[model samples]
Target: MKNSKEWYKLDAFAKTYSSIISEGRTTCFRLSVLLSEEIDTDLLKKTALFLEQKYPFYNSELKKGIFWNYLQHKRNGFSVELENTYPCTDVKRENPLKIIYFRKKISLEIAHFLTDGIGASDFFIDLIEKYLEMKYFKREVNEREVGNNEETNNLKYKYEMEKSSKNEKISEYSDLYSKYMKRVNKEKTVKHAFHIPLKILEKGQYYVTTGEISIEDIKRESRKYNTTVGKYLLAVYFKILLDKYPQIKKQIVIGVPVDLRKIFSEKTYRNFFINITPSIDPSLGSYTLEEIIKYVNNYFKIKITKKEFYKSIYKAINPMRNIFIKSVPYLIKRIFFPFIFDYYGERGYTTGVSNLGILKLNRKYSKYIKGFRFLPPPSKRCKIKMGIISDESKVYLSFGNLTANHEIEKEYFTYLRRRGIKSKISTNY
Candidate 1:
């Protein structure tokens, strides 16, 4: 173990936010793939050794009670433990990677902070394919993407300006509203135990007429409905819910995570992002898909302007208890977060839909890979959570937190397939 050194300031902020909000148990996403070969235990060790050697940052620990501090400079990194814990420092004496290669299912759970929806897609796809090749092809394969260099110079604003915008104040969360905050504070946050099963997802080459769809296509379609692609997708999902859960009348709000980089010019490799801008909750018996699209599109178009972007950033960064909580220690932040949540209402959204838009990667895996799909973290709020991620060729629709909703997932794939597009659904369902 090493003594704590000062971490980048932004990293500290990210650590603060995540520690406060992350419940630990449901924060990670579990991915299951069926394997064809017998367990390659030695090769699994080799792969872990290869990763550690290739990316030294994977061995580092969090300091100042902040995970982001450990990751600020390392854009791509992960720490392997014999087990999981916050501020994990110990290194694995044995190979952390495991393989079942059973007739059933193989699986892996990924920490959300390690990668976003887009990044996870590449990693998962690459990992599966690499494992396959190692067993069958007997050849080493590299699927890592390169050159995610910061482009602050090309942006219009400075990081400080963005920081200032992020520091603005917003209306506080009412204690009456943030009831879950207390449970979160005193609750024993469950850290999920490791489980990589042998479930498999079938793969195939998919092509679409809209594979060549450019920004112009997105913009044109958006205008056709007077909405962004995000709003359009929200409308589609909302319709699916209506079709499935016709009896439920609660507000159907979809959480949309807005990337601050779209507005700010900060290039720091930390999670300085916020999930704001919910779609208009469709009325119980009244709203049609087109109507929901209109309402959501108009609302997003109005709310996500430069002014709203900065305002939302400010609300997330500038703590309501800043002056008072300032006297509170960093360690206390993790313990007493429910007090804050009780005030803030746990980010007023029901389901999450993050659009990393299109995934961009280097020449690696270009020839072998067809596309990508983003599966959102399973929600305690909703039974079925959906996300869409695309490459140049196809739109991959994925659902998470769904224990056995393959029928519903199949319906979505069928809907897209009927639209004259190439599609596939991947899940244990």
Candidate 2:
């Protein structure tokens, strides 16, 4: 109800998204959690409202400034929707973020401007926690508070207590991408990678195919190669692509997003990860899975270093920090930025795979939760975007596709199945 919120510019990672967002190319992602039973819609609605106060950035809207763009906050109310369409569709600028609940799941479909997968999960987890607290734990405490005139106070106390646990740095709105940015020598450019030429799905359609497999299985397989699970998976991914396009000469580049928070003591949730392109150049000749893994791991080892990583991060942070780029009026920047982004950004990679790592839920709330899934947003050039999240037992691999074909996803899982990693596939076809 108040406009006391301060003004801020869009984070560096959001510049491309902001420009292309208007062309109906809003880069978006979905974080979903399943519950033990059907969701209590009424209570989930209240939980969404409460979580908003805790994460006010979700309510932000983009406004064009003369030189750049400004993100203005408006405490506009949002209503949860029933899950009907495929997950991770393009969210319009007007309603850049939304919460939709299915029977046993609540999915947050948010624009890239909102936050990264990790940031989204923070809010999604809180929403689930608050809802469960109200449904079970708070009810457990309700009998105590009902005996006095402190009912309202008790509720507010719970709100404040939970809210207080969160680090206040979340509200600071500092651009972590820019904050940790280091100037580097000539920023290297990415050449065009092998693009999946699958038939595009109908305009209103998006395909999400999930493969649920045991984390232990993945670990066992990965260790056999002396590589981590992510690198191992990329090896298999490259192998699959190489097999499918045996004759293609281009590199099979996948955008593997790195969490800068690991090195930089940053807390802003706006958007702060950089994609490291780990690729397989088919021209190098045929290679086995182990060879592919070795190649992928080598790329990863080199990229993680401070010098190598900043070179990549500098490319993204430079535009936002560049005086010329910032001074070129939003109108002109918007016109050329999208073209540059699609050509330079997404064009650099064939597809993207982001691993959000394992999620360990609180014991108190574990019974109320089922599992979690991460769906990465697809790009114009990259037909399929993938995400991986693991709970204690299983790893969930979701492919958000724009194509009618399931060949790539099917083959990826098929490779895992051959390795004795059984995968139960599900899709929103």
What is the per-residue lDDT of model 2 for residues 1-429, given as tens digits with 9 covering 90 to 100?
345454556777776777776322558788889888888888877776665555555766677778777776665745588987766665766577888998888888888876787777777777777788888876532323322234553464345334423533444355677655777874564588888887776665678899888889999999999998877877888888888888888788888888776656666667777778887778878889988888887877777866776787887777677778867888998889888887778787889889998876677988787678899875668888889998888899999888888888999999899989999888887
Cα RMSD (angstroms) for every candidate in the order listed: 12.0, 4.3
Candidate 1 structure, TM-score to reference: 0.58
Query: Where does the lowest 10-residue lDDT sum fall in candidate 1?
Result: 171-180
Index of the highest-lDDT prediction: 2
Pairs of colliding residues, candidate 2: none
Per-model clash counts, in order, read 14, 0
Candidate 1, 276-342: lDDT as tens digits: 5454333337567678787776767676665665555454444633576656666676677645553
Q: What would the TM-scores of all predictions be?
A: 0.58, 0.90
* Alpha carbon lDDT at 270, candidate 2: 71
